[model samples]
Target: MSLADSVSVTVKHKSHAADVKPPTKTTARPALTRLERAERFWGWIMVLPLLIGLAVFYFIPFVQNIFYSFTDLDQFMNWSTFDINNYLDLFSDDDFYSAVFNTLFYVVVCVPIGLAISLLLAIGLNQNIRGKALFRTLLFLPAVTMPAAVAMVWQWLFNKDFGLINYLLHFFGVSAVGWLSDPDIVRISVSIIIIWSSLALKIIILLAGLQSIPRSIYEAADIDGISTLRRFFCLTLPMMVPTLFFVSVMSFIEVLQIFDVVFLTFDRSMVESDTMTVTYLFYKNAFYLQQKGYASAITVVLFIFTMLITLVQMAIGKRLKVA
Candidate 1:
């Protein structure tokens, strides 16, 4: 071959060799170490008990409740054939409607008022005021108190003839009010008790939220000569949205299921129709009236209502940019 031909042939061979690349090797994930494997196994072991308990206690019973709602139960608690009559009867019952109305009234009256008062109390306690720790303890005491005891205390305070509340009213020339008896005023009376008892936990929550806010923000606002009132409206409120949202949601759920106050404060003979909450009504049906299937249906309705309300609150919170 000529020298140029030999050089050209060598270049062609080099180019062809470059084009034919070597096969790539597949990479496998590294095997976990024995320690890591043991850690994972222990983690699962720790969580398994909780999962089992939840399934056994909560999930299974919840499913059974739903099933029972669709089936009639005889006096002996034996399940009968499936039926939708319970729901039909529930819709037509005036007592059911009254209970629903009363429950909604509690929600509407208690939650907002409680939230406002709680926020104000939290702000006051968060200040550099003396005895704040004592105040906090006193405010939070109600949250830890038994619901039945609290109801009993308020029942005495609401006595028409000789209660402290009526005594004070008489001093101001107002007539003695029937706090637990009259249909027109008993709802408000119960609402007052609910709001009072709920304030403690809400105040604690708001106080924590307040403490989480950086002091530097307030210092900057002070440097700008911002008034405390202005700062609260412009700065504090915007920052407290998440905490407020949480408190409102919890309050709504709690108030919707109010039973203790009504059950403890009033009897079947004393304006039961006016004071009956959905939960109270459920208790009456399940235990007192032997209407287990009907009570189950009430619970299902309550569950649906709670879920819908929670969804609406979450949507509103997202719209407001709550964290």
Candidate 2:
């Protein structure tokens, strides 16, 4: 066709293309659609039974536990018999003081030592090596094992006669220790068990923390010729502080609430004091002595201890943020 005719046709086509409206931008689905709301409603409905169970089994009993601490629940059904004598008596009781001291000592000694050992394990396991999966699984076994079972096994192992530990000690020409019998050594034995049982979880947590650390940071350290100890202190520890903090708090709580291991390991038939953890004492007072009110007081004290630890952690976290 003629040049003007071709040019006119091309211009017409361009005009038509421009006139055609682009597909209207599809509107986004509304937030919380009817279907979404339905799903959420069902979710809450499914959880209703759990909420009810918690209220009935935990919340109500928790309030009553606190109330019982203030009252003489053992002596009378009436609130009129209520007094602060339970608190007064708890303070006066030598057994209570010893139990508190023993429990606090366990927590103080075990948590830091356990964390240090578990961190070393995590570092070793985190290294590029053969059979690491098997190693990880073996390390985590204790975390899944039943506490009572561990307690029983350790009790047997710690036995002065015919025990694996003592047998090993004898082989090395060391005397068999009165691990369970001696009050001085009882806390150490319990601490050992706590460390063994708690090691698995802390190792897993720290391994994850180690893995989460950016590779670039290590590369930079290498480029700067940073020493191993310097790299660890400057890079690893600081970065892993949050995880370490969490692990420390959890370890403290677990050590503080220890019951099964201490109960299983210690010989209750003994004349000498062996196992007198706060929880053990609480059980002895609550059930064996029929002083539920006094036991409740002990429980309240434990609750306070846990809350204080959490609060201190929060304060430290705030300070970290400011820094």
Candidate 3:
């Protein structure tokens, strides 16, 4: 072959060799080191205690309560006898019906009014003022107070005869009336305590929300010569909606299950057609009368009530763009 032919043949051979060589395959990712895997396992192990606690205390009880609602739930058989009669009996009782109504009423009245008061107080406290920290501490103190002790103090304060409330009324030339003993007044008394205790926490939450609002917005509002009320309506209130909704939902749930003040404050004699909350009634059935099955059924109904109300509030919050 000529030199050119030989060179061309060599080039062809080089091309063929290159074409026959396959692309390199990528190796799989390296397995995690044993220590790394162990660390991950340990992290899960650390959380396992909390998960088990929640399952045992909250989830298990919730499910057991539902099961007991469908059974006789007596002490003798350890609630083995499943029956639907307890639930049927619950709906038939007028007292239970009243309790349902009262509990709903309590939730309705307390939620909005309490939230409004708290928001107003939070706004006031948010302003630069003397003794601001002291005021905040005083306001928040009620939230941390023991519920039972608060109830006792309020009982004296609200007493119809020579009570501080009655004395204050006398100063205004009003007559004293039964506060705790009277069915008509019992709800009012309970509502007062609920409102007072809840205000502090809600105020604290709103204060946090207020602090989160961009100060630039307020400065811009000032530059635009906006009125205080207008700025609040346009900017402050809208921004606070998320916080307000959260606080409202929490307060609503708390009110729905209000038992400590109502339980320790009033008795069966004071249980009015209007004053007996579902929780109070539940206590009566479960502990006082030993009707565990019926009480469980009522508890189930209450759970449904809370769930539905929460869902409704969530829907409304979504519409309000609170979430």
Candidate 4:
């Protein structure tokens, strides 16, 4: 009698659970309808503020700059003419040509060297060393520092007389060279500052990329008796290509727009054609000379140049399956 009763109870419980399951599951499921769709759309609506901000602050101004390029507009007023005079003027102006050449030169020199130094630092940091965090922090410090402050410091250091750099040269029995004053040295000095300023941040990015690589790959390489340098080239460098490409693009753009250090270090009279960047030229046109329209034109040209270079880099990056 007791066994039958227990079996009957179990069967009843199972039937009850089976009956309740479908309704419970259905009730727990989220409802889908017009209102729910509207609610779902509100998720995107939440980002509207950010979208609006970007449109207003970035897109509108950029488009306006492109428009203003053709106009002979200035802070005073628009000239009674609309033409491509600004662009034509840029071609005729020797200083403008020099700025263009100087910008290109800076990019060619700084970007590759900066990327190499950053990658090397990243590799060194990836090795298990004492006080690793401290070293990394110290390296990254300059990246976050004010550019003006760095320019001031570099200006003093690059001084021909009573400067640390020249004093160090004295130790090596080399004569003091005019690092900032001489046109030849000006471009080189500026490039050095740029490279030094960028090294820390790029190292951090590449280090992160390196850390993401699995230890199993390295272990396999070692088991095959691959040399350390060979493993780095074959395994590490290939995996880090995407990050390296990104750093290269960023460094290229940064070097192109170089102004603050160039401006602070050199007076207008002292700065030669070789050292004047497009941005510095832009400043002179926009404020000093009050040729805002021409400055706007130059800005558009530089922006287009940057966009083209970045697009080219991205295209090359996509084609690269070397990894």
Q: Tell me the TM-score of each prediction against the true structure.
A: 0.90, 0.84, 0.88, 0.86
Best-fitting candidate, scored by lDDT: 1
In candidate 3, position 82 carries an lDDT of 82
Off by over 4 Å in 4: 1-35, 77-79
Per-residue CA lDDT of model 4 for 1-323, tens digit only, reads 69999999999999998888553444567668998899889988999999999999999998888778888887886666788999999879898888999899889999999999989889988999999889899998998889888988998898899889999999999999898888778889988988998898789889999999999999999899999889989999999889999899989899999888788777777665558899999999999889988999899889889999999999999999542
Clashing pairs in 4: none
Expressed as tens digits, the lDDT of each residue in 1-323 for candidate 1 is 99999999999999999999999988988999999999999999999999999999999989989988887874577896798988998899898899999999999999999999999999999999999899999998998999888978887899998899999999899999988888899999989999999999999899999999999999999999999999999999999999999999999999999888888888776646788889988888899889898899999999999999999999999999944
lDDT of 1 at 91: 93
Report the number of clashing residue pairs per model: 0, 0, 0, 0
Cα RMSD to native, each candidate? 3.7, 11.2, 5.6, 11.2
Query: Clashes in candidate 2: how many?
Result: 0
Q: Each candidate's lDDT (Cα)?
A: 0.91, 0.86, 0.87, 0.88
Clashes of 3: 0
Candidate 2, superposed: residue stretches over 4 Å from native: 1-40, 75-80, 269-272
The lDDT of model 4 is 0.88
Clashing pairs in 1: none
